[model samples]
Target: MAEQHAAGAEGIHPTNDPGTPGGSVDPQSGADSAAPTRRARRGGSRKSQKATGGWGAVREIAIVVVLALLIAFVAKTFLIRGYYIPSGSMEQTLELDDRIFVNVLGARTGHIDRGDIVVFDDTQGWLPEAPAARTNPVRQGLEFVGLLPDSSQQALVKRVIGVGGDHVTCCDASGKVSVNGKALDEPYLYPGAAPSDFPFDVTVPEGKFFVLGDHRNASADSRYHIETGTQFVSEQDVVGTAFVTAWPLDRFRFLHNPEDVFADVPAPARP
Candidate 1:
């Protein structure tokens, strides 16, 4: 009976350790299993960081682009704007399809003087209908931001010949246009082109301007609109003065106002 009790005690106190080789559990196996899980977690964290970094770069680029567009919009609206010349009306000074920069501030301040080349809106029915052209939203947006030339259909460019209350007439004995009795020495006229092909005599009304094109013979400017009572463009319709030729790099130059041409003329006679 004592021998049986001794055997039972030995069975209850078995000496094989669980973590040893050939035992039920191996500590090294558990460590190896856990190592794969840890590697998988590390790889997932790296991928997540990479994705986040890519998105951050895209967001920064978007912000920079938006800021640049906003600055261009403001400059085009109030400070300076570009215009595309569609006709040869102001030839020898500005050519067809030439891009020009206009000073909006000068026009707004009423700094426009005689002999200055100006762009004006066709408030009256002075301009003929324009031919159709293809356009898309993308092009329109570029034009609005001043990245492209202005595409306004009713804009005209001309030289100021007379201001408010000034007497303007064509064809003196020397075949020259006269302003306030002083014949103008117009060197800017197209070669061999007369100041005017026909005779005209009129007094510029208050707050209006008498304008003519440098290419007088080819241009149907104020003269053509005289019979329709749209002879003069109002000061309010002036957009700005073309101060610089921007495109066709070879022909680029600052536009001079030719103040000497109007130096001898007197101011408008007030009633």
Candidate 2:
């Protein structure tokens, strides 16, 4: 209290008021009385402004973060989504544990082309029923917002061999798979793996697709589901087209459809 009073006193300026009966001055110290209350109010106001500014900055940062997350979620839901390869079924093309970005819009008719890898839901019990995934809240939240790939999804990635109304068969005269009478010289197949270990010939029904894995021998794709007669995967069940190998920086690369492999093949005949 003593120090504050002395400090205020030292800051006082000498003044004389004409309205006073006699502009009397203090004999010891000549100065106007210091307004300590006003000074203290100004000091408190500065501190309050500083605190409000800090909170405002924080609020702005929070809004930006929320907007970014919303954009990611929208993209994941309708434009693109991320997934992690969990099996060797697509080996050599998509290695096990590789992360990939899938184009959700590409699942539409005519967008998904032959030789393009795709991710699809296992709708018809293609995959054995597994218990619900148990994940931590943090990791689950990240996946929900598209910051992390959802590796727990019950989905499969395979190459599109034939789409809607096309004839797809395995082991042509040259032991290669054929679509619409053109043999596929698949260089993406797993090393030492045949085009297909089993033979199958079928015309994909309208709005359905015949898919196979790059590692032919090890994959139980459309061919392995024949016993149920639901060998063809419906177009409606496709999640998206896997268009990149995204994880393990050393393996980062855009996934392109082997269009050249299907270019020479004629389109399916329309009835």
Candidate 3:
């Protein structure tokens, strides 16, 4: 008997053929499919990275621009400013070359007291012949930004002598101007000028102010209007007080409201 062949000798019963997968694809196609899937995943990752990098650059540029704008706005609003003197009105105290800085917040916050030098609008005709006197809408707008030169029309700076109702009589027996019956010893008065040469006896009206120049002889201030009995500047006309001589390092100085005088004076009675 020829070594009896095994009954089911076809070997293992033909496995479910993982390579054929229900007669769909061949073995090589399976390998080809995996290659494309990996390539597509890599391409998507590279595109995502590029998009992220582009947006990052844009965000950086936007941040820089925003910072620059913020800095400019802050400087314009609350920091150092420049102004030009338009006339001889505030001479000796503020000359033509003098560029000054004003403490606007202080003035608004009641830091401006008597004898504090101030800059304001001359719309009330304080300096009738000032170059900035006529139709100066452009100059007036620049005044708000502090960009215009000092000589701009419709602006002036003076000393606060009388606020509200105070008998602001001039040329007292001592040649001193009296406020509410007390005489002010003005040391800042210009040499050769005695308080005021032209006599004024009017009591400053309520809600109005009496301002004069440090250089009374040259200034056409309230005294000029008083001499003519024409126009007087009201307190509302005050823009803000000048507190510093900012430019020309040689002339740099801080202004103080003569402590010795205002200290003795009493507060004004409420109306």
Candidate 4:
């Protein structure tokens, strides 16, 4: 009977002992199985963490690049700009091939004044060339991106001769132009060229302006437009008043309004 019972026990299979040596399970075998399972779980957790951190770093980098591009676009649109002179109309003040920086912000708020050398679109009346080269669609699009060609395509730089409502006339007895019946003693006029040799008497239209160049003889400015059959450049045509000479390191200077003479000129009486 005892031999039969032992034989029966040997035939029965051990149900849950995967780490057993010979089917008779030991506590050490179970402990060994636990170790491998714990190790695998730890390894998987570490790999997941490393992948998550790497992706997070990549996402941050992409966001920074996008922000930088947006800022560049905004600045190119309306704050400041670079301009290139393509003509010698403003010679001795601005030269050909000269790259200049313009402040578009200040001009937007009516801060432009007399004697300021301004850059404006010559689409209508100011361009000297025949078949005037106005701002074409392509150039207009490029202007927004700050990538316009390094040449003025129907743009000009000239000083504001008379503002909104000043009566401007040329060549007084002393050969000086007068604003509001007062002689303008201009110190910046080109050497040896009178304020204006040609004669003109016009009241500046409301919300309009009269502009001229410092270099009189060489410049074909308001005087020429009046002499020729072209409309005067109104304030609507003025782009922005120039405030600086940003070319030829030696000629750089701040262009302040020539206020000493016009300061005393009383505002024209309302008609």
In lDDT terms, which candidate is top?
1
Q: List the residue pairs that clash in candidate 3.
A: 84-149, 84-150, 84-151, 85-150, 86-151, 132-153
**Candidate ranking (TM-score, best to worst):** 2, 1, 4, 3
Q: Candidate 3's error at 72, in angstroms?
A: 4.8
Question: What is the Å distance of residue 164 in model 3 from its true position?
Answer: 1.3
Over 4 Å off in model 2, which ranges? 1-30, 108-110, 135-141, 149-152
Residue 133, candidate 3: Cα error in Å is 13
lDDT of 3: 0.67
lDDT of 1 by residue, 69-162 (tens): 8998888777788888888888878889998989988988999889989998887867777676678899889888878755565788999999
State how far residue 66 of model 3 sits from its true place (Å): 5.6
User: Clashing residue pairs in candidate 2, if any?
Assistant: none
TM-score for predicted model 1 compared with the true structure: 0.80
Tell me the lDDT of candidate 2: 0.84
Query: Model 3, poorest ten-residue lDDT window?
Result: 1-10
TM-score of 2: 0.83
TM value for model 4: 0.69
| Candidate 3 per-residue lDDT over residues 92-181, each given as its tens digit | 677766778776566555555677777777776654574434537766655444454445446778888877666677777888887776
Better of 1 and 3 by lDDT: 1
- Which has the better lDDT: candidate 1, or candidate 2? 1
CA deviation > 4 Å runs, candidate 1:
1-26, 29-45, 149-152
Instruction: Tell me the tens digit of each residue's lDDT in model 4 across 28-127.
Output: 6544333444567688889999999999999999998667656655665567666777777666667777777777776776776666777777766565
- What is the clash count for each candidate, in the order shown? 0, 0, 6, 1
